[model samples]
Structure formats: structure tokens, C-alpha cells
Target: MTRIGLSPLAWLDDVEVQRRAAGLRRSLRTRPPVGAELDLASNDYLGLAQHPRVLDGGVAALRTWGAGSTGSRLVTGNTELHEVFEQELAAFVGAASALVFSSGYTANLGAVVALSGPGSLLVSDALTHASLVDACRLSRARVVVTPHADASAVEAALAGRAEERAVVVTDSVFSADGTLAPLRALHDACRRQGALLIVDEAHGLGVRGTGGRGLLHEVGLAGAPDVVMTTTLSKALGSQGGVVLGPTAVRDHLIDAARPFIFDTGLAPAAVGAARAALQVLIDEPWRAQRVLDHAATLAALCDVAEVPASAVVSVILGEPEVALAAAAACAQRGVRVGCFRPPTVPAGTSRLRLTARASLSDEEMALARDVLTDVLAAR
Candidate 1:
């Protein structure tokens, strides 16, 4: 037996193997133009991502604080803007406190890993985002992935795991299918089992609950001592960052123990400012929440009218991955941008076009989207 050299490392290829197994992988496109066609694929629920106010707020922060945080939160990076944003966020989301992170992915990673460790058991939904799944892996906790949105399955996983601390984690709105988790039922189960419930309301924050307070509050679990929620500012807020909100003690624990917050550079001042502004906008325009939900239902109804099986995402089911990709391509070609959920991203045999709705969409835009979607699906 001999060790492989750097030259042999070049021959060792997982990229080609994955390509053969999963087809050609997609690459990121550079900053897309706002003028490019109708967009039903982005997570900009309130259409505030490119709003003048948001841009101006971000620009002001950038000018005041520079381009990046000088250091991590525990270091010199903790800015006054970050503090203000967190306080505002906590108040808006009905949490005792909130801790902001550089990205929502890092926020989930830090929260999950810090809250549940080697002697802990983490039960998560099968349909959760990749970030949560990765956090479970990094936590070194005993991970039990239950059936998607099945509270009973979750309960069963915690039935006899008394030796270790257990936490039930789930996404409030699953990204791929746009389905919601049974937050109340999961909370009940966790409460019964003496476990903590961590709800990922990344998609839910701007789209669900009363006035977009989120699923946890809507289900009467927000202020609960045992219920913790994490959300992304990049979505509804149209800013880039993540925050974990819960009781003061839990937040204090995260401040001291969460590696992402302590070790990574604090969220940029611009992002914090933008998030603050976005939250303020939400407070002023409470109707935005209802608009997005209404848009989602409208998309679903149009799919139904077109004889397409639609879920919370209003996806046009394309049996084959290639078909889904092609459909997405066709939509893009027709100046209607949409999302394509395929293998690995979506569960096996559930490839489809995932179209998200926004409060900013005019009635005519939605009608155009429906027409394009129906035509695309029919052609497929």
C-alpha cells in the first residue's frame, strides 16, 4: 500500500461521479437584474429587497460603519446598529431577546449545535432545510429524522430517550414543498417529553401567523418558556442575517455558548440597518403578510384550475428532474422566473417547479405568472 500524491489527488474525482449520478450541477449566476422579467422564484415575500428605503438604509449604515464588521461579536465587531436591530427584532417577533448572526445558515448551525450536543438527542423533520440537517450532523447529537410534518412520528422518536437531553427541531415552512410543520403538536409532544422545541421560521416569518408574527406565535407557542424560534432576515426583511429568539436565559446562553456568534464576525452594520428598516416597514404595512398568503393561495388555485397538483409551494409537478429543469428554463425564457426543485434539494421522485408568491406582485403580474406556469406545465 502506498500513499497517493497530489498528482493522484487530481485523478480522484467526486465531482465527475456526482455529475454522472445527479446530472450536471447548476452554478450560481451573478447578481441578476431587477428588470429581468417577472420573478416568482425569489424569497422576497414583501418585495422590499430592492426597495428604495431598504437600499438607502443599507447605504447609510455602510457609510457609517464601513463595509464589514471589524471582528466577531465578542470582539470589536458588535455594532450599535446590531444591538438596535436585535432589540427591534425581539420586540417585533414577540421574543424576550434576539441574537443576530452573519447568515441564517450560521444562525441555525450555531443554535442547533449549541443547544443540542453529544449527550443530547435532536429530532428533526425529514423535510427540513439543508442547514438544519448539517447542524444536526455537526452537533454530534443522536439525530432522529422523523417523517415530514408528522408529529406522532416525532413523539415516537422521543418516547424512551430519557438518558440524553432531547430537542425537537423543525422548519415552520418547509422550503421545497412549502408545507408547514405541526408546531403546536410538536410543542405539545416536546413539553410532555421534557424536551425543547426549536422552530425554524425562515419562511414563515414574513408569510404566516397573525401579521407575520410567525408560526410559533400563531400556534400559541411563541412566548412559551420552552419554545425557541430562529428566522432569517434575508427573506421577508429583505436583509442578510439570521436571528434566534426566545427567553432571556436561552438568549444569554446562546450569547455565551454559540460559536457562530462569538467566533464569527457580527452581521454587517448595513444588514442590521436594513433589517431594522424592513421590520419597521412590516409594522407600518401589516397588510403585507396577508398579501403574501393570499398570493400563495391564489397561485395554488391557479395551479388547481390548470389541473396541476399544487402544494403549499404551488409547484407544478414534473415527474422527471430534467422535465422540472426544462420547465424552469421555459419559464425563464418566457420572462417568468421560477424555482426548480430536483434531486437532493427535493425528496426522491418529487421533482417540481417551486414558485413562491410575494406581497409586492400586482394582480396583473400574478395573472401573467399563472398563464406562463400553466403553459409551461401543459407543454411539458
Candidate 2:
């Protein structure tokens, strides 16, 4: 008779037990393409996903190019559509040049790692999106995490760094809480330290700045030699892609050096076309940006949140993960859809209902949302 060790894979059962006990389990649910639910959970802030022109743009590309990009961008996937869209994006954002990636996550990885490495210092905002946090870890630079949205902390990190090269990365609008960053102050600190600044405008594009040109353009730092910006087409442009905008040299460098860009497939033709059409729409309908902001304010008031959201996101912290989950269920049961964020997505004890405002929501829709949210929150 002998004692045997637990099976190698059996530990997962213990982990599951711990997760359930901590109330951290998560699962996904499907929704009909056309649903009765009032959606404030999606990232389609401008509500362009169903816009006729946006659909037509994607469809036209599909008819011509098929579904997938045939190969990596460097080899066979480069198309006229991609080049044109890159140019359009650069002009729209007032950048000297632009390069597109398959996703915002890849775009952040490319820009951060290409701009930094060993002997360089990377200063990152603690509250940045997870994508950026992952990018910093992969950069192989002397990494320093500063207080959330504190430009002075960034300055100190950059100023005292022994490395000759430095890069500061932040989100223009924090994704979880929708807090705005001090872009101006951050840029000034980077300038003083002669460090490069990278701002991810994933939440700010098509929802901030005049004409949805993005927070970098809004702050007059769009084409600065020491500055770069990354954004997603999925969130604002109603398409699936990512972009890095800055000096032409940076684009060239990424094309040669960035592992994510060099090895990854180019963005699909349909996404490029949809993004281009969506950009034109944004140019024509600049008011959509302000309208979404207005809608966020309305949601804040309805939920009794004190401050109006800085971007389209509004977070209503409901304590433990289980509490937030129940509240989200309550909203869905009442014909409204909102996002529920728990641990890993957010910190412990700060689980929340993350609401996103859409520009295309009709007045009646807004009223419905107000009633549902008011009742749901009041119950909580």
C-alpha cells in the first residue's frame, strides 16, 4: 500500500472550487441579431455598425476580395484598399503617416516594442488597458508603473531613468472607469525628458475631440515628432482593425522590426473598406461625437452617478462580483443590456455595471434606458 500524488490535471478542480467560492465565475450569452433589448453594453459608440454605408462598404470589399487576407501584410496581403485607408486615417488624425494592424492589441504591441527595448525605460500608467500592460512586459525595457493618470509620476520615472531612451504609454480614456488622461501634461513631461509618448485613443476616437479626430489631434499633439497614437477601428470606425499614427520613420521601423506586424496577416479588405467609409461618415457627421458624450451624461444622471463620464463608458460600482452580476441580470430581464465587469477585468471589490452610450439611440430608447436603469439602480 502506498500514497499516490494527485493527478496532474486534477488541480483544476480545486481551482474551480476556489473560483466559485470567490464568486468569480463567468460565462457568455448569445443575442439575436435583431433583439428587443436596449443595448448599452456594446462598444459601437457611434452606432455605425448597422449604418447602410458601413455595411455597403464591407459588402463591397467582400465581393471583390473575399473574406480573409491571403497572407501576411509584408508578403501578399498589402492591397490598394489598405494603403488608401491608411492615408485617409493619417489625414483625419493629422499624423505624418499611419500603419494598420489586425487589432488594437497588436497595434499597441507593435508600437511599444518597436519604440523600446533593453536600455530604454518604459513608463506605463497603472490603469491602462490590459493590452498596454502586456505590451510593456514584452518590451524588454526597464519598466516602471506610475500612479493612474498622474503625469508627474510619469515625469519622475522618465527624468530619473538612467537609460537614454524612454517611452510613456497611457490610455486617452481609461477603459474600465472611463477616466480621461492628462494628455497635455503627459506630453510636456515626455518633451522635457526627450522621451517618446504613446497614447492609446481606443476610447477617445469617434467619441472625443472635435469631429472625432481623437484626443491626440484635439490636444495638438497628433503629428509631434516625439508622439504616437494607437486606436481601434472596431470601437469607433465600425470595422475590425487597429492603427498606429505618427512620424513616417516610426511606421517604417515597425514594418521592419515589430514582430507582431511583420509576422501577422494584414487586416482584411472588408475591414479596411468599412473603416474608410466609416471615417468619411465621421467626417460628415462630427456631431455624432458630441451626441455620444451627451448620451453618457444622460446615463450618468439616470444612474445617479455624480460625474459625467469622460468617454462613452460609465461605471456603476456595485461592490462584490455577485452583486454586479445580479444587477446586470436585473437590467437584462427588464429589456435592457449593460456590461458587467468583475475581477480580472476590474480590481477586487470594485465590480461594476459598465454602460456604454450610443449616438444612434433614439429619444424613446433613451427614455426606456432611463426608466430601466433608474429602477434597477434604485433596487440595488
Candidate 3:
């Protein structure tokens, strides 16, 4: 055999070594179908991922529509299931319309890029999700990143922007810290500056607001002319895909202009059906949202964390990547699974364990969580 030359990607080995040295390496673990571990790491806030009705919805859709969407939504991929899901989702969230995407990331990309372009200004929160950050990059808009949840900063940016067209972007509930953005204040600011507010409700939907209609709806901003919202079905809905909710004109415009929406294949039938089922569950069982919040409060109290979470996310800052990793491992040893977040996911020196509360967690599971978290934190 002929000797092969050194590969061009050989430098990636050094990068991996650096990551390991910095304690920032990440790996995936395949979870068992039925595990003994108490799940605190997953985003299944409402716990509908394993619900019988939700599963049945997916199964029925799979039998009827096959596994794939078949093509882009502009083509043969636009099914009756998609239209029905969209209509139901829009009505449930009090939006004028909704456009579904393959994932939350792509939905953010499509909404941000399509709404703002060269000569427009995008005022994004500093702690906004990475999806929105990437969308801002792709937008080619003059981007101004303000301090986290600071409405004044957003207002100032919007007021000072040279461009007449502006969009103020923020997360309704920040994913890492679980703190809420001042939605009312931000909306008022946007209104004064004639700017549109784009809120990513990924963490807020099915966890916050009245019956999980979302934070915007709770604040009376849903269906507002100047507001746009994007959310995920994979999180609270316990399914897969994303939706951009706003005015009818915005939906039509995205249909025509958004590259991600135009080029990407539509969401599969199973996800659409499952998400619709989950939405209905949320509607019928409003208490599920409250249960998750109560659970999060209980976990936070047991963890002795200073800040109370506004949603299902409860973060316990450990100040170092290695320490957070060790803490998570300690919890795992006690049959509790928690997420360890480090730099890039979170800022350096603020690495932490991210725990998500589930509505379906039993009393025994809650007790176990409290005990495990208390023991782990005490050991530190």
C-alpha cells in the first residue's frame, strides 16, 4: 500500500487535546429505553415525550404519512397535518399565523434573516440563545448586543440605530440562567422606537405564563403587530421541529424569502402529529405547567441556589468546568442525571449543573432529587 500524506484536518487532534486539558470536552451517552436514573438533564418539561397519547399520535402519523416529509414545504411536503398543526399552534399561542420549521435553530435563522438585512439594525440580548446569535450573523444587519435582560439597553440601541427598520431580539426565559427577560418593558421600548421585537420562547412555552400559552401571551404581547415569536416542539412539546409565529404577512414573506424555510425539508408527519397532541394536552392539563415550576422551586431550594428559576431550568453555578463536571458525576453516581455546562455554553468561571424539572416527576423522584442535590452540594 502507498504511504498516505498527512491529512489536512490533523490540527483537530491538537484542538481536542486542548479541549480535554481545559475540561471542556463533551461526549454523548445513549440512554436506556427504561432507565432507573432520575432524569434532570432533559428538556422534557411537560413530560409528554413518553405519554401514551403523544406516542399514539406519532405512531398513527407514521402509519399514514410514512417517515419523511418527502420534500420541501413548497413542494409535495406540505401535508394537511402540517396545515392543521400550524393553524392549531397559531390559535393556541394567540398568533396571527405560524410557520413550522425543521428545528428551532432553523426557525430562528429563517425569522431573523428574513426580517432583517443589510441597512437594518438588530438589537440582541447578550445572553440570547446561540441559534439567535447565528441568525444575527447571517442577517448581515448592524448588530448590537445589549446586556442580558436589560430593557434600557435595548431601548437605547433601538433609539440610536441609524437604520429605520430594526428588530429587538431576546429570549423570554434565558436557557442557561433561567432568568426572564422584561417582556413588557422591552415591548414598550420597541413600540416607542418603531422596532419589531423578536422573542424566542423556547424555554417559556409549556413552562411559563397562563396555561403555557407563552410569556408573551401572559404579558398581552402575543399577536401584537410589532412582536414575533419562535419556539420549539422538541422542548416542552416533547416532539421535534420549530415554529415562527407572527403576523400573516410575515408568514407569507418567510414563505417567499426565508432560505431555510424554502430550502429545508418540512417537518415530518410524526413530529407534527405528536406536537399537535402535546399542545392539546397542554390545553387540557394546565396544571402540568405549574407542577414543573413547583418542582423547579423545590430543586432550587434543596440545591440552596440563590436565584429562583423562572421556568423549568435551575442552574447551580460551581465556578469551574472541572468542578461542575465532578458535581454532575456525583449526582449520576446517586442515580440522578444532570447536565454539566461549561465555557462556550456558558461564560468561563461560571460553569454549572443545569437541572430541568419535569411535570411527570413523581413524589418519590422529587424526594430523591432533593436528597441527591443536597448531598452533592454539601460535598463541594
Estimate, for each residue in 80-124, the C-alpha lDDT of model 2 and write its tens digit: 899999999899888999999999999999999989999999999
Ranking by lDDT: 3, 2, 1
User: lDDT (0-100) at residue 192 of candidate 1?
Assistant: 89
1-380 in candidate 1: lDDT tens per residue? 67756565665487777765665477684546655689888888888998888888899999999999989988899888888888888887788898899999999998999999998899999888999999999999999999888999998889878645899989998887777788888988998888999989999897787778887878787778988889999999999999999899988999888988898988889998888888888888889988887788888776663532222256666767777888898988888888888788876677888888888999889889889877887788
Model 1 ranges with Cα > 4 A deviation: 1-14, 17-24, 305-312
Extract clashing residue pairs from model 1. Answer: none
For model 3, residues 97-208, the per-residue Cα lDDT tens digits are: 9999999999999999999999999999999999999999999999999998889999999888889899999999999988899999999999999999999999999988
Rank candidates, TM-score, best first: 3, 2, 1
Q: Count clashing pairs, candidate 1.
A: 0
lDDT of each: 0.84, 0.92, 0.94
The TM-score obtained by model 1 is 0.94
Candidate number with the higher lDDT (1 or 2): 2
Alpha-carbon shift of residue 50 in model 3 (angstroms)? 0.3
**What clash pairs does model 3 have?**
none
RMSD of each: 2.3, 1.6, 2.1
